[model samples]
Target: CIHDTRIIMTFLLTATFILGAVIAGVYFFIKRIYSYWCRKGVEYIEPDFFYGNIKEMVHGKISTGGLFKKFYDDLKSRGLKYGGCYTFFSPVLILVDLDLIKNILLKDFDNFINRGMYYNEKMDPLSAHLFSLEDERWKNLRAKLTPTFTSGKLKMMFPTLVACSFGLEDVLSEYSVTQDAVDIKEVCSRYATDAIGSVAFGIDCKSLKNPDSEFRQWGRQMFKEGIKGIIKA
Candidate 1:
């Protein structure tokens, strides 16, 4: 009797394991390949679970602007109109209907103000910037800061921008004659870092001119992709 009971228990455990595995596999498989069901005559592609329609997004396979364009086009071509598709069960909300986008972004702006993107205050202060804030906080902050970036203030900044451009041009001119490819992103970033430094802190950071400059090195490093994103993600 003892041997028979042990054998039954082992069989039960095996069955349970098999059932769990089957359930999990089926869910992911369905999510990845068939998350979105067509609305009436409209056809739509599905997205993976957890990652949603974010395979290309999180991977940086395409620029965000381009991805939005693609998403819009896919839905528009199929004439989805006002229906939403799944980003792994989370609605992608294809606004092929122009009226809906207009209502959400411009017309009925009060209701759809908050976006649920990640912004860890402790981890990323820059990420906690105005656009990241939500609801009343965002509205109030925007109103408060509206006057800070006025046309007059921007006009005042024009000269500073010109000066920085000249500095960059000067630096670039020395390297242009050489046939070797220049890292424009790196050079431009250096110019930007130094410009922002001068503007914000009243510091003369000649990051563009001096390769060995401590500020310049850090400036370039900031633009370079590092372990930071990996850690954060």
Candidate 2:
């Protein structure tokens, strides 16, 4: 019994030492990543361990767009044309100057090409979209798809947009007659659905005609609050 107890104590001590080493390694790794801006002598928003600088956004207190705008304003107030932010452990650069943005996007286009999105074509084939693509692949795909967004194509779709606008005006006009107050959120969503469906997919969502249409329902599903939306936001 004494020998067995000794063996058990030794095993427990070894396991605890290994676990403490791992914890210390991870903490140091995270600290190194977070110290990137400091090493570069750049101003940056400080980040918490898990939520980073987006605590409000993570907790659903502010929207993703709102958080970005707030960060932009804060950086701008500091008279900074560019600064860094952290998305978890990843370093992200934010631009505040329009001229600098134009230079990066136009004059230095080649250097700023990749969007740095995670893409594994083998595991998720559809994940190879333009926004997620990088390098030669992105250039090739962009060249192929550029013609679709040309002014000529937009001109061809203009009439369809007009038709959708008329449909929205008619719906709002009819609604105002009986109901003084309108759920403008729903009305505008349906209008956008009809417009996008007509122009982009060549299908009329008929969102105004059928409020509970599958397309509109699917759009609502995209905003359903839970782990997915929170993570996305």
Candidate 3:
């Protein structure tokens, strides 16, 4: 009986040691991430142990827009010009001052040219647009696209715009007579899709007439994603 009791005591002590080590490891992991802003000498909001500052966002309790608004309001109320925030373990800088924003975008634009988004042109050529391109590539693309938006070009496209407006009016008039509750956003998106398709692609998407038009279907596919899809991405 004494031997059995000693064996049980030894097992309990080993279990306690393992448990303590695991807890300590977790604590250190979180502490290291939390130490980032402090090490940089930047003022930041204190984060919850597991979720950091975006607990609501990570849990899907608040939307992306709501999360940003919460951060903005919290910092703004404190009268901070700018503040450091965490999106999970990652640290982010939030700019609150209007004059500083104008200076960054206009007066000192070259210093912050890239939007720091990932884009692979070889894998997806369509992704190689003005928004994703960096440095000299962006400058070159801007110079090329500038000519397409010239006064002469816009004047040439005015007729197409007028035609699209008439088409939209006709589509809305029909919807008003038939449906009591029309999805205005869906209708507007369809109209815009058709208008751009005709003018730019020279192909009739007929999105207003046919709800499941090729262009609309393509657009739907682009935005479709599950949790797995997000994880993979």
The candidate maximizing TM-score is: 2
| Candidate 2 residue lDDT tens string, 1-233 | 99999999999999999999999999999999999898998899888996778778777788777888988998999999998888777787888999999999889877777765666678766567787789999899989988988999989989999999888898889888888788998999999999989988999999988899999998787555544555533
Residue lDDT tens for model 1, 104-143: 8777877766665446768666566576678777798779
Of models 1 and 2, which has the larger TM-score? 2
Q: How accurate is candidate 1 locally (lDDT)?
A: 0.68
Q: List the pairs of residues colliding in candidate 1.
A: none
* TM-score winner between candidates 2 and 3: 2
Candidate 1 off by > 4 Å: 2-45, 56-112, 211-233
Give each model a TM-score. Answer: 0.62, 0.81, 0.66
**CA lDDT, every prediction?**
0.68, 0.84, 0.76
Off by over 4 Å in 2: 1-9, 107-110, 116-129, 133-137, 178-186, 223-225, 230-233
lDDT of model number 3: 0.76
